[model samples]
Target: MLSWVQKRGTSEHRTGLETPLQGPKQRCWFVWDPMGIIFAIATWALVLSGAWVLVRDLLIPSNNVFYAIANGVVFHLLASLALVSHLRTMLTDPGSVPLGNPPGPDTVSYCPFCLCAIPERVYHCTVCRRCIRKNDHHCPWVNNCVGEDNQKYFLLFTLYVGLMSTHVLLLLAIPVLRSHARGEWNASSTVSLPGPIFFLFLVALMGFIFALVMLCSQMCSIYKDKTTTEMLHQNKHSQGRQSMWANIKAICGPRVSLAWLSPFHSPDRYKVSERHVMA
Candidate 1:
């Protein structure tokens, strides 16, 4: 709800944001933001590295047009989706607390720093320097606070990345099998695979394992209608399926199936207002 205002008598709109002198709910940034840069560099490095290996060894050299094209299509598609989602998550406003608004009947609390009505599930992120609606943990890798507005994007990014890693691993298997069948590959020769081939296999495996663990953890939190922050403190609930699904719809939007692959908004999503249970 907090929108930036322009400086009076100036044609330029105020650019840099400053946290007001509110309580702990607001904080002035003291250091440079390094997360976004690190995340972007790491993401592209892995993706490009994997693509080079796959196309050079498996996709192109295989001389199978259909296989190459199909794998290329799927791989690049996932990478694009993942990259786009990551950007969306990083750049999006993570549901700010409405400033100077009186609390409604259901809103009984206030953010100490922002002095805004506190709805259920909203919390303050010191790193982000604001109170976020339905606040999830501030993810360093994405370089953003995961909140109601961008949680879906965060999850979709994770899903696509995990799939990308797994798919690359599958692609790596072909050459590995051939080498093994011909008795040309041995444990000692693990170091002898082409540089790209070895790098792709190792990176893919590590990526898949890391993403799988993170994905499973996130899924559990979503299923229970809880965030990792809440889960860390042992938050538990016995909400009905409908309630849980409502949380899903909140994050995944209405068209759950299409939502994962695309960034289009569905009609049903508009009807849903922002809401979150306090941690």
Candidate 2:
């Protein structure tokens, strides 16, 4: 969930309009916002297109052991995981604070604009038009808020997508570079890769760089047990009392040992609550 240039106070472009208060209602929080939707569409279109081309080219890689792993396992599993996590992050609601009256004294504050209870670590998202649980950032790529509910999916998506892109680039890089330098692909080669393959490789490399940066930033936030929002607004932020491992488990789930490393294996994953955290 990378929001590099997010205007923190800007109201949602379209959904910012406060719907007429019904007998008890004040505003709409479930309506769609077009700014994020458009960015998500364009970003995912490029991602899917590049992934397709990479997978197509790597279907039957060289008989060498390294290439075999790259083609058979890494390409299929990582790409699939990347796709799933991406979709999950995009579709999953990053958890909105319950509307209306405050549930309990635990709520740290109240949002005047939305007239909703604001809990600890949660903040109002102007774009989402709601207070998000453990609010992190609004990611235009996923067109969703990255908060307590979907942070894990967002992280996994970033890591897997970055790895997959790098893998594709590595696999095709030699051929692309050699061909470019020599001015022609080797005619005698058993597999004749398209010229566009080089361009695709370059594209994947760029994606890798972008994802890597996001991954590192997310990891740093996790290590500090802070959300991007909290980090950005340090003066106004207060964090939960959780250790580093507790922070990781909160996001990666109980099956992090297995699920973090593989997409095909979902070995009884479950979310940890605030009670599970250590001081």
TM-score of candidate 1 versus the correct structure, residues matched by position: 0.74
- lDDT score, candidate 2: 0.66
- Give the per-residue lDDT of model 1 (tens digit) for 43-80: 77787777777788879987889999999999999888
On the 0 to 100 scale, the lDDT of residue 169 in model 1 is 83
Model 2 Cα lDDT, one tens digit per residue, 1-279: 012112211232233432111124334323267987787776667767776666555554454666665575767777778878877787766766656533233444567666754446768888888777777888887888888767888888898888888877777777667776886755565665576576577678777987988999899988887788778878344655458886677666654476665433323323333522322
Worst 10 residues of 2 by lDDT: 1-10
| Backbone clashes (count) for model 2 | 0
Write out the backbone clash pairs for model 1.
23-113, 120-276, 121-276, 121-277, 121-278
lDDT score for residue 149 of model 1? 71
Give me the candidate number with maximum lDDT: 1
CA lDDT, every model vs. true structure: 0.67, 0.66
Candidate 1: lDDT over CA atoms?
A: 0.67
